[model samples]
Target: MILWLTVVQIIVAVAAGAFCLVAGLVGRRPSDFSVGALALVELLLVVQVVVAIVAPLAGNPPTGDLLEFWVYLVSAVLLPIGAVLWALMERSRWSTVILGVAALAIGVMLWRMQVIWTIQVA
Candidate 1:
C-alpha cells in the first residue's frame, strides 16, 4: 500500500466526518455539499480498493493478515454508502449524525488498515 495514499484517506475521512458532524449539529439535513463530500470519500475508498488489489499482485502485499485487511477494506467501501442511504431515507438531523458516525468509522478503519499494512511479518 502506498503510505501517502493511506495518509490522504485518513485525512479525507476525518474531514468528511467533521463536515457531517458539524452539519448535524447545525440542524442541517443532508445537503449537497455534505453529500458531495461523502461521495468524495467514497471515491477515495474506491481508489483504495483498486490499490489494495493491484499492489498485492505487484508484490506489495500487506504485512498483516490479508483476510483481515480485505475485510476492513470492504467494510470501508460500504460504510459511507450505507450511511447515505440511511440518511436519505430518514431525512433528518439524526441522519446526518449517522453519516458523521459512519465517516468517523471509516477514518478509524483506514488508520487500522495503515497499521495492518505497515506491520512487520514475524
Candidate 2:
C-alpha cells in the first residue's frame, strides 16, 4: 500500500467521522451531507482496493501477512456500507453517530492496514 494514499484515506475518514459526530451530537438526523461523506469514504476504499490488487502485480507487495491485510481491507470496505444502510433505515441522530463511529473505525483500520503493509514483518 502507498503511504500517501493511506494518509489521505486516514485524513478523509477522520474528517468525515468528526463531521458526522458533531452533527449527530448537535441533534442532526442522517442527512445528505453525512451520507455523502460516507459515500466519499466508500469511494476511497474502493480505490484502495484497486490499488492493493494492482500494487502487488506492479511488484510492491506487502511485507505483512497478506491474509491479514486482506481481511482488514475487506472489513474496512464493508463498514461504511453497513453504516450507511443503518442510517438510511433508522433515520435518526443516533444513526448519524453510528456513521461517525464507522468512519472513525475505518480510519483506525486504515492506519493498521498501512502498518501491516509497510511496517510489520510477515
Clashing pairs in 2: none
- Candidate 1, residues 1-122: lDDT per residue as tens digits? 88899889889888989999999989999987777778889999999999998998998878888888889999989999998998888899988988888988999999888889878562
lDDT of residue 60 for candidate 1: 89
Compared with the true structure, all predictions reach lDDT values of 0.88, 0.97
Question: Top TM-score: which candidate number?
Answer: 2
Which regions in candidate 2 have their CA more than 4 angstroms from the true location? none
- TM-score of candidate 2 on Cα atoms, chains taken together: 0.99
TM-score of each: 0.95, 0.99
The worst-scoring run of ten residues by lDDT in candidate 1 lies at: 113-122
| Candidate 2 lDDT by residue in tens digits, 29-87 | 99999999999999999999999999999999999999999999999999999999999
Ten consecutive residues with minimal summed lDDT in candidate 2?
113-122
Off by over 4 Å in 1: 120-122
Deviation in angstroms for 45 in model 2?
Answer: 0.2
